[model samples]
Target: MRPNLLKRAHSHNKQTLNNLLHSRGTSPHPQPETISGHKQIEEETLPKYNPDHWYPVRLGEVLHHRYEIVVKLGFGMTATVWLARDLQADGNAGNRKYVTVKINVNTLGEEFQKGRREIAQKLFSANPKHPGYSHVRFMLDTFKVKGKHGDHLCIVYDVLREPIDLCMEKFPGRRFSCPKLRILLPALLQGLDYMHSECHVVHTDLKADNIMMGLGDPNILDHFVQNQIDHPAPRKAPDGHGRVIYTSCSDFGEPPNEAVIASAKITDIGLAAWGDEKNTKPIQSNAFMAPEVILQAGWSYPADIWNLGVMLWDLFEHFGLFDRIDTKPGHYHPEQHLGLMIALMGPPPKDFLKRCAKASIYFDSDGQFKHPEYIEDHTFESSIVRLKGEEKEMFIDFAKKMIAWVPEERWTAKQLLEHPFLTKEKEFFSATPSLSRASTASISSMIPSRAVTPGIPPSSSPNSGPNSSPKSVPNTTLLPPRLLELVPSVSSTECESSTNCEETKTEKLATNNEKSTSRTSLSLRPKMESLVESNNEPDVEVPNSKRLSVNKANKCSQDIIDAILSKGKNHNHRVSPEAK
Candidate 1:
């Protein structure tokens, strides 16, 4: 007989054997036998392999007699995710409902159990419909499965598509377009705001890997699953546990067109903590690590903002913002990282430097940086000078606010959502079929202008064309006074000069023929001494309404300056009084 015929015959024989055993009132799988207390103790003490190291469970195995293990999704440090079919699905034909099962290693003992229980309570007790929970992945149910290593804790979640890192891998470069960035940043921030404020949880770890692309349409998922069922991938050999590891056939193609890739959800809350909980272990990924975290100073929600900012830079530029190659073995150079930060953003505030435990290692007593070689002659503007259109300005401006040396100086997620860079109206999200027409329109209206111009390099000249200039389309919305202060706006002098020219253009032209060209050239100068001298000599009275706006703007600026001074003044303290 041919090999294919032989395999079919063998499968038929195995099925027949299982049927025979079922008819005889016995199970094909082995059952556990009762043992004495001494024997049980001996078994517990014996050397046992971790179930996750090898395939702990078999394909077709009924977990808790409801979810039948279908394929292995992936594995993590302490857990393994599997795609499983729900046996108890409500009377739907052909297609069965599938879920992701996360099985965590349970050999970690009592302390691990206590921590797991706390996390479970926090996750399970929360309201899923809350706005804070908007971009967060919600748990469905949990159970335990007894294995040779120990009992494994299994968590069930709605089947998500893939991680943002995986999505980036499929693209030509490991970068997403600005439109995608707009969608992704807003959703992530909304989730962060919810987690920080309503849930009172701090996700110490925020990165591309932890953020997952949401499975938008049920039909699309069903189709993907159906494809797997029709054309299954080849199975691998069984492990020591006599279980074959089956790889999932689900194809997570480049960022899928069917779903809004921006509709991402933050995952893996195992490392997360309650807002007030004190953390001993170092947190955050190396590249995204905040200065406070590096210095072992007490950090809070602001650390997360710092992480988000770095993540955003990675998303936009497809490179790590603070990534450095260490010259010394067994040690990362903090001075190099700090030096780069200082070079890009001015120097860290004196107060921020005072709190650093190893401040002398990098900075002198006078707060001047010691490592000049590590510093690059780069500012946000100089770095993004190549970028075409207003993106160069907007990106640098947005980044400056987030990558501040002082944590409190960083914009909160809520405040960042209102930024013009993110709010610019665009039709990018409209291409996603999953979003409704109304939703597409609503999102587009919030944006000030489209930031993305495909195939154009950042270094491209801003004067390429009239259409290329973002200034051609004026932003109609009046920004809040507070936001106006944060962002560099049209200077009052420029505004006054422009307004005056617009009102008196015809009158000026009529009065001057030879002087018209000279007058135009002089007026264009930003701080012409003659113009300034003339304006200063006049004692003009301002309207009360105009005076009120100016006063408010000044107050806002003063308050910001005072806050910085206050932070610097209390740098010697263990915990800043302002933090309280």
Candidate 2:
């Protein structure tokens, strides 16, 4: 253990504080029987899987001693994953700290090294001091696994016991409340920005199941194992359905139904680029591919926006817009993807579709999709998902901008960042360096200092309702446009009202940005009944004053007996704390 970390632990219970500050969602625990490896685990398991429970992977096993593997938190194509602990770890670490580790000397030979590099790059990017600030990024601590097969890189990270996807899965039909969803979006966006903007990387596999949350550091000797229960991978096609399902849309019979604002971080990258695009690898991009990417038209950053836009659409409608549609077939050529474009959207603009250069998209007379000859055996079906009201209008707008058949027409990250919906969320949930010693020390210093500018400027306007406005906010594109509507007015928010207030506040107060599940149900809230009512203002009641119009201010006190109420209550909640 680092000397400083040990010294700091003596003064501050950093471990407890770390647990309290984590931002993970609580997924339901499996039944005792199932957990113990003795029940019919749900279809969430895989073909080569154990249905009963979760297990952990610990790299520090031989390096240290006495630890055991507990559960498997996540898995990628290259390696198995586990959450582990060492009974004899240094300091109080033996008590059970969540640690994640990946065994490298498994499948996928060369790609393994690339994944290792990605982890290394991701760790560097995750550092606040690093040029690429990532929220969903992973950390890599190298370890050796010496078996008959030899050794390799084992990635390690803080463990996230519960994943948000499983949490949503347990709830089944209930959509996340606006505040709850907002809390997660910022981190997901920052994560995406890291992969896209800083790394020049594309996460071909962006989905709810891929994104994870973790707690603390995992040294080499932690308890670890692997259990194939509650598979977090994308769901597959059933016999009759015949189509692989990437997005889940559980319909709970209710009006104003909310969807799981899916937790998104790109995963399963480079599969599309690793091999011959013409040969078609066994791995697939599935429904997330944009038309430009599908057609292989010199794609770039906007391709990610296209995928994100589609992901948002799936969240709202419960299915992939282009899923089941055989956009491309016959040797997995990019040109065949045009079939998907025409199906999801009516048809691209002639100029846009004309970029096909290689294949025929239409007849000379109509410029319509005529000979879409790719799908022969399999009938193409548009997931023809429906959208309503504001969602419909907003989604279509974003879809047009993102899913343009032509790559050039797609919206850039800079443009999406400024969209009104996103701008509002960005403004409200403005992330500031929360755990800086300088800021804390300054606050504790006795000397007077210049007025500080708040990270997200507090609202000082009369129109301080739900979404006050999108002006004055930069980096707005961190959220999907439709979801941005609920970004609370940053100034007026309190722990009591704004659901996202907690996440935003913590991201401000601490850059560590732990995911926590603290929610208040209105029905269970304690009413302010004034228990000491005996001495309260009553009996000699003053004459009722006119209701304070929102347009005016009203302030009065006992100091002025003849004080007249002329102004309205301060609509803006930016109050300065008074001197003691």
Candidate 3:
């Protein structure tokens, strides 16, 4: 009976070997030694961190038999990030690859564990060769290791130099310059656009803390890694949960250069979700929350635009746009925040107010704040006191369009990309002439019919015949030739109606210009008449009061154009005043 059992076990082992060989597309028993060597190699390549006992992670302790912990990067609620060196990197001697390792403190919750796997799968699925991938922080690898409490998840990422918040802290007053903003905003928007469109994900938490400056110099990174290794700092005492706490320290002196900051990538997408998904849970930091989010109204992509507007304001002002007041021990005054929004952006449109579930709590039926005293002592004009003439006008104009009471009215990422503020440079326009042409076309299509008065003879047009009226179009306003030059060719019919038409035309141009330039002082030139054109529909007649408002807006825009042109001359920069 013993001999029969032994023979059966031997036959089963032989059958398993045969199956393995067949799976490898090899004949059974043809390469037994090679198969045994492959198995040995596979075992060696597997992670070595013990699952039963937590490894004591000292400053110099190696992880996965590859990475050696060098420096504590930072700590969050659930994890501590560490800078580590890849000891197994290919080199003759001493040269090592640096990486950021985020170690979770405890065994992750079911939701977080699922999120981590989803993120890893999505990141791994992305093609590294795509240019869009450059804007996002890609995961290097992930593994599980035993911790003091339980098994911890360790996520590896490319070494990012610093978070934007920390980087900004080094600047004077923690404010970024317009030039720096120009560089960073575009990169950030590009990253966001890719995430929204390509990845089909919405970064529910978009803030300075989640945006990081990319690697600058490899030598500098190596130097910093070596310094950490040479001078190991003691880890702080573990918390109640027995997880070690560590403070981030940087020995690499001085803030990063503009190039590094310009390459900022969005990180910390732990709260990210599908763009179309219904997220009932609270999202985004309170200070950056959109009105839709605050009121518990349905939200989607436009919510992100609102967040961006607030972020841009913070970048320029070095403070949050919304001031939160502690009404109680743990509660914040949401109504006060709404009042502040009203004070800054004016009241929400009636349609928007109707949609807001909490509108009645904060605003009266007429759209005035229910508690006016709760409003902050601030206005758009007052907030931008630090900016000069054109800068202030451009900033306010751009912000108003984005911080609209109605989420649907906010300019989309793609539309904002073509705004004058972003395409102000001749080089930018020259490189992407199609965008400028498309923008011009879009503006021209919005030209109000009031631009062409009723009872005006066809002969009264700019291309009128020799027998045309000599009155030369009533209330004609001449736009700066430079402003006219910036606009693409409109239909002869639209151009011929009236000279005063230029005011509304230029006002619309300024609005578009303001949209892009306010974030970063991009050179924006106003396009033609559209202020009276209600919501891009030309046939609608604008009330006299609205027309007057358009006139005032045009006058202000004209002033901004003159100031911008003057500033350009002072800086010895020249932008073409020629029509494309």
Question: Residue 108 of model 1: what lDDT?
Answer: 53
Off by over 4 Å in 2: 1-67, 74-76, 86-96, 104-107, 110-115, 126-134, 149-152, 161-163, 172-174, 177-179, 214-284, 326-340, 349-367, 371-388, 423-580
CA lDDT, every model vs. true structure:
0.54, 0.36, 0.54
Q: lDDT score, residue 112, model 3? A: 78
Model 3 scores worst on lDDT over the 10 consecutive residues at 1-10
Give TM per candidate: 0.62, 0.49, 0.64
- Model 2 residue 251 distance off true place after TM-score fit, in angstroms: 22
Q: Give the TM-score of candidate 2.
A: 0.49
Name model 3 segments beyond 4 Å from true.
1-57, 92-96, 123-131, 229-231, 234-244, 324-331, 364-368, 425-580
What is the RMSD of candidate 3? 19.2
The digit string of per-residue lDDT tens for model 1 on 1-580 reads 0001011111222235645665424853332222222221211222453434432667568898899887666655566677888888763632337888887776556676677567656755576676547688766778888776567778888777777766666654556655456657777888887776566677888888788876666555567655655555444334345644344333454465424565688887877876656544578766777887776655667678788877866665644676553533356777777777877667776777776676777778898889888887655544432233234334555665467676655555665665655653221111111222222222223323322121222223221333444233223332433322232223223333541112211222221122211111111112110111011121222121111221232333334334334433432212112111
